[model samples]
Target: MKPVSSECAVGIDIGAGSGAKMGLFTREGNLLGESLLPIERYGRSPVVMVGELAGALRDLVKGSGSPPLIGAGVAMPGFACSDGTVRCNNLPFLDHVPFVPMMEQAFGLSVCVVNDADAGGLAEWSHARTELLYWVFGGGWGGAWISADGQVRYPAVDWDGDDDTLHYSNEPGYAIPLSRERMGVELASLGGSWEGFERICMAEREWPGGRLAGPNGRLDCVRAELFVSGNGRWRIFRTLAAADGYDLARLTPEERQALETPSNAGRVIDRLAEQGCPVVRRTDLMFGRALAAAAEFHFRSGPRGNCPDGIAIYVGGKPSRALPWFGPEAESVMRARRLHASLKLSWFSERNLNANLAGAAVLAWNRLKGS
Candidate 1:
């Protein structure tokens, strides 16, 4: 008797600003292969996007030697709707588009969709099956809450376009506010300036993408994302340098220029932090504090009865690769505040898995099993 082939799933991660990644994975979550589709290939045409994505999916399935496909799960950088539509701000072309159904219709495959950040959480949940916070630090901080039962709690599916209505678990960076007064205190201790930081924020802040208001539309505080993100960390570095009088003797101008690249800045900061550069160390400390501040609000005001006291925060995203530098400080501060939660590097990170794609695969497999 011949052995039956294992069933696989298709996982597609769509980045609004970037492009799309498609991967084939077995039921056990091992990736068989993957492909990339550039945004330019699809452009703004929904028909084109769907056609290209269909080809990619077919290629993945064919490349896997005609293994039975469980289903397809798509991850997007936007809020997902029940009717297979997505509201993507960055990819204006995809906003209000029935993206999931389009892809499914094109390829005649069962398909599901989820927010990218939530997808990352599902990836972690697939491993731990516990209540946790999944936070991704990029240009903006994105997040999700996974229940102990492996469901995404408080997903932003029904968002009304008001930042204030978003739940802390679903949008911690946008809904949580780091205290301005506390920031001033943190800055003063390290010879940094709150005024200078504000100035930089004002100059760099983009419309609609950033908000000066805090949780519930309070004006006295800044959204946690303004300081806890990739570019946000760079802003901290810039502000501290200007305030404390940058010591170029320790870091060359060329190195300083390299730090301006968000993709490369985390590595540079990690190296400099290891070398004990005062500014880099202090900047990380400040960033960590803001991160703690977000967590504090989440635990204190979130669905406390549902989650355990020591809920783990699984960190994701390229920027979070620097968690080894900032996570310790955040953990320490949370401990000092008596918040029992721990800041943990994501399971995806430890396993060297691409969080979005892996998570999408898990989601697809689960849907196929009627979970």
Candidate 2:
């Protein structure tokens, strides 16, 4: 038999607001060459964007001087269906766009379009071939479940709400406070009343500030998830600030700057922990437990219960990468449940900064192999 060609593939990660990044990767997940272009460089025109992306891909392959490119993969921030239609709220240009066909035509290769979060999950699963629960904690929180065979379960079943993204702010139980009558019983054991808690939250006097306070705050409808890194960190900061001894003044200008823009919040929280703030640890623990609770909730009611055991949780994005303790903290929460399944945590970048791209390439490589 003629030996099969061991050619490389191309992967493109196109995230909203971050422009486009393309890379050449061997089937083994090694990044061979990479290139980038700011989204604005294309003037937000789809035709122009695809043309620019195609040029970048050509440059990446040519620059690498690697094997023939066999396939291509594209990752973007949006809801992409297997049929190639994408509904992107963040990348308005991609709304109802058939990006797969566009890329395929541009590059003359089989192309796959996947959600950015699912791309991360695919990368993690490729490393272990285990049941993977990968969460990307960047601008916002997103998660994907992969079967042991590396099949990603898409269109994650929504949890008891109209919201799509999984964050505490949108989760039913955590989204708001219980009613006054309901709170009486809920808080009776804790020796506090719902009314009292609402007062503090409404006054912005304590934990659960205006965003999570008042009857209006407590009974608000589903809001958009905080996909912005700065917003996510601000949420963490406010939650931690509620606890006693949290020195708000210790915040650096950079840290404070994160609160105003969409940036990595995990790094700031980790820095605060390094600064000797006990509240940071406490908040991390809370956040970790919240993640566990989300997992448990999904296992019980969501669509991920089938492969509970052998599950590995991969954490990445700017924040989780900076905070090494994030995994353990979340693991502690998962273990505390004493459930049927065991979970493990690791970084998505255990291989490279181009983990998403690596996974996209892997998906394309696998597609070619299957064909």
Candidate 3:
């Protein structure tokens, strides 16, 4: 019999901000290469954005010396259905657009679409030798999970008792209600939105004295410009804390100094822990978000009685002291270790490559094997 041609697949991960990444992999799960492309969307015009992105991806493949393209898997933010219609929250441009057919026409390849967080979970599971895996998106606190056999088993439309209501796990917007009624007001006053918090964190890092550039003494500047710009809240906070005392008008000199001090942040984290809440550093929060997603996945998928052996993979930057409010790395390690021991599972972090690509490779390999 003639040998069957090896299948090659590509995984495309689309973020809420129209950021795009593509991963190329062989049927055996070996990664060939990956690239990031920009997708410009104009208000609910996902069709246009996907078309533009498909063209760019085609160009990337062509530029890469013509690697054979078999199929493509896409990870997109928003509500996606089995029929391929996507109702994107962050990128309204894709609202109810038929992305699968459009991509098929543009690239002439079979395409599978999955939720972005689900894709991250699948990728992490595929790369590691674990029976359970979780993927978390920190910016909006979105999460998803996969089982040992590569099946997504949590946060499904009908999984929990709530059949009528759709659940978007890990989306802070959908988080368990906070008891403090003024918490929202406090969050807003601090910056206005979660994104606002991230911005103050980032500006505090990128541009010292940047806080003074906005209303509320640079609060609006960080909110309007930096935080909303992308996912760099931790960096922003670090920068601001390190800057001269004048940058933080919100806090008195003594308070600012106290915040900048390592011991203070540790105490804050300890207080949160004392309350039975996990006080993750912004950096570790990013890491734990991913881990939590994996844990949730396992809890929902494995036998109801016990947890399974699994792994959590995180893709991001190394934690730094710039984000003092996030607490210390030692705290993160200790917490993670305790969680793993208690849950009887394993967790791992990889900051090098995007997790979506790793997921696409797995999907492609599975399809190639007819599994």
* Clashing pairs in model 1, backbone N/Cα/C closer than 3 A: none
- TM-score preference between candidates 1 and 3, better one: 1
Q: Cα RMSD to native, each candidate?
A: 2.7, 6.4, 10.9
lDDT for each residue of candidate 3 in 1-371, tens digit (9 for 90 to 100)? 23224456888877765478786777666666677776443234656666767777776666555677777878777656667666675776676677778877877887877766666667666655455434242443344545667766543321232312323232222322222222223333333334444455544455445432322233322222122111333333343333322244544566556555333443333333344432223333432333333334333432331334334423321222222323233235335544442221112233445665566556655554454
Better of 1 and 2 by lDDT: 1
RMSD, candidate 2, Å: 6.4
Candidate 2 residue lDDT tens string, 29-76: 777778888877796788888888888877766667645788887777
Each model's lDDT comes to: 0.82, 0.59, 0.48
Residue 172 of model 1, lDDT score: 76
Poorly placed runs, candidate 2 (over 4 Å): 1-6, 155-233, 242-245, 262-264, 302-305, 322-329, 340-347
Candidate number of the best TM-score: 1
Candidate 1 structure quality by residue, lDDT tens digits, 1-371: 23327888888999876689999888777887799999988999888999999988777677767677888988988898898888998788889998878888897889988889989999899887778889888888989889888788887685788866777777777777888898888888877878888877777646443656676668788888889898889889888988878876666777777776665677677777788888888898888988887787777874532355588888888777778778898999999999888888887787666899988988888777655
- Output the better candidate (2/3) by lDDT: 2
